[model samples]
Target: MDDDHDDFVGCDTWDEMTAWLGESLPDIPAGVTIDFGPKDLHIGDEPLDDEFDDTDPIEALCAQIVVLKHGRYLVRRSHVVMEATNYLDHDASSATPNLWFDDDPTGDCTAGSIYVDDAGLAAEICVTWLRAESGLPDPTEFGFDISEATHLPGLPGTDAGWSLDDFLRRLGH
Candidate 1:
């Protein structure tokens, strides 16, 4: 409420974090599809809860979300902390693209998730995160632009705006 970073209460657990994000962000635009984290558990070095047996199937935190927009893919990843959302070029002819898992040296190998293709939705998601984190009700009031949002390795031209054409032109297609 104070607009201070220290005053903002970040999530302490994965469930809290993901659920907060899901509720805080706007619904994905029509034609957009999103995939959450894998059903399998990737607890890494963390100790398993006493309530479950070693054979029990634990659900992994919904940390990796992939949104496919305009045939391209944008990955929203969260490690110990949430990271900048990222994008990948459209490659396969299939409806769903294969998600690759990076083997963490520390051993947290959780696969990413997905959403349907739509650049505006992607940008909106980024802006929403920025607003939530910064405690800004109206992003523009603070002069926040999509460019200043959490889009990692960002889309090409700042002129194209948050559209399919922007991604296409940036990719040089």
Candidate 2:
């Protein structure tokens, strides 16, 4: 709802992107596991064998966010654990990424779009997340639909949601 987020689009570094996400989406809660793989020079991801490029400033980043109407793995009443990921072709290219969100940790991105800027992509992802948390569907105003995808086949995160550890261990970390 805040068009003021345009300034963040110019950010091209991991620190800057994370800082912007933190400040803008403060209500997203605290203590969620994060793979600062892109923030580093590619040391952490090699262990997990995750697919990402190290040539750019930020190749990949994911957040295990909380969702509504479903429970995480091994929990009946817990909120569903979902992940939002931003992947780029490479760092420093300024290519608009199509951020993905899904119910399962290893699930393919169920929702997203092709934006002209980075900050805008982040902003739209936040908006979609907030909307879904409130029981709303993906914002079609941005030009895409999560409902278009078939249900993902995968396991859940913890009651706390997907952890970087789960993703790692699954990848032979």
For all candidates in order, the CA lDDT equals 0.35, 0.28
| Model 1: per-residue Cα lDDT over 1-173, one tens digit each | 01111111344333333444344233322122232332132344246465755553444322333433344445443223222233244332354544443543323324333343544444444444444544534332221012122333866633323443332233232
Please provide the root mean square deviation of candidate 1 (C-alpha atoms, Å). Answer: 13.9
Error of 2 at 117 (Å): 2.4
Top TM-score hit: 1
Model 1, C-alpha of 154: deviation from truth (Å)? 26
Candidate 2 on 1-173: residue-level lDDT in tens? 11211122334443444344444322221222222111222232344356545442332322222211111101001122223333221122342224322343434332322322333344444443434444423222221101111122695532434433333333232
TM for candidate 2 is 0.22
Highest lDDT: give the candidate number. 1
Poorest 10 consecutive residues of model 1 by lDDT? 1-10
State each candidate's clash count: 9, 2
